[model samples]
Target: MNIYAIIETGGKQLRVESGRFYDIRHFASLKSQNLSSNTKILIYRVLLICNEATISLGQPWLKNAIIKGRILHSHLENKITVYKMNSKKKTRCKFGHRQNSTRFVVDSISLNGKEL
Candidate 1:
């Protein structure tokens, strides 16, 4: 049976799948010359594993609800523009920035959405 589950990371929830690259959070700055060094990593812990049939819809939880994923790359994102302006005041400033993040994929989701 096909399995799909929701997992949380970096103050966000991600819908993941196997062999599919996704963006994640990277707290550290990347300064390496290699292109791969700038990417953020996203990895999941095997907390719980379960199947849809085993999920407790009304109850607290099933016997074992698993969540799992893995970090792939830590990379930079597109630069965003920041602008400040006043209607009549002679004050203006502009800046651009790129956020950092790691990539990950849902390897496999079993009963608890963890690897088999």
Candidate 2:
């Protein structure tokens, strides 16, 4: 049966499927752990999951439901220009920002105490 799950990470909710890759925001403190690009990680905050015709929902987060994934890579996002200008004051400020993000590949989904 085809299975998928919704997980929360980096203050965002994402719909993920097994064997697929997604780019997500990086954790601030994870850099201290010296995580490699191929590191495997388990995310336990599953919000919802659907297996074939059956669905399970969590009241915030599901117990015993987890998403296993691997870190494919990490990179910075495209730079965005922030421009602030005043019409009469003749003040113009410009800045560039780039966000750090990580690429993750979902390996498996475990639900109801079993891996699917």
Please report the candidate that would top lDDT against the real structure.
2
- Which regions in candidate 2 have their CA more than 4 angstroms from the true location? none
Clashes of each: 20, 0
lDDT of predicted model 1: 0.51
lDDT of 1 by residue, 1-116 (tens): 44455555556655555556677664232333332633333334322233445532313233344544455566778889999988799899999989876665655555534454
**Quality of model 2 by C-alpha lDDT:** 0.86
lDDT of each: 0.51, 0.86
* Candidate 2 local lDDT, 1-114, one digit each (tens): 378999988888999999999998874336725557888788988999999988999999999898888888888899999999999999999999999888889999998778
Name the runs in model 1 displaced over 4 angstroms: 27-64, 112-116
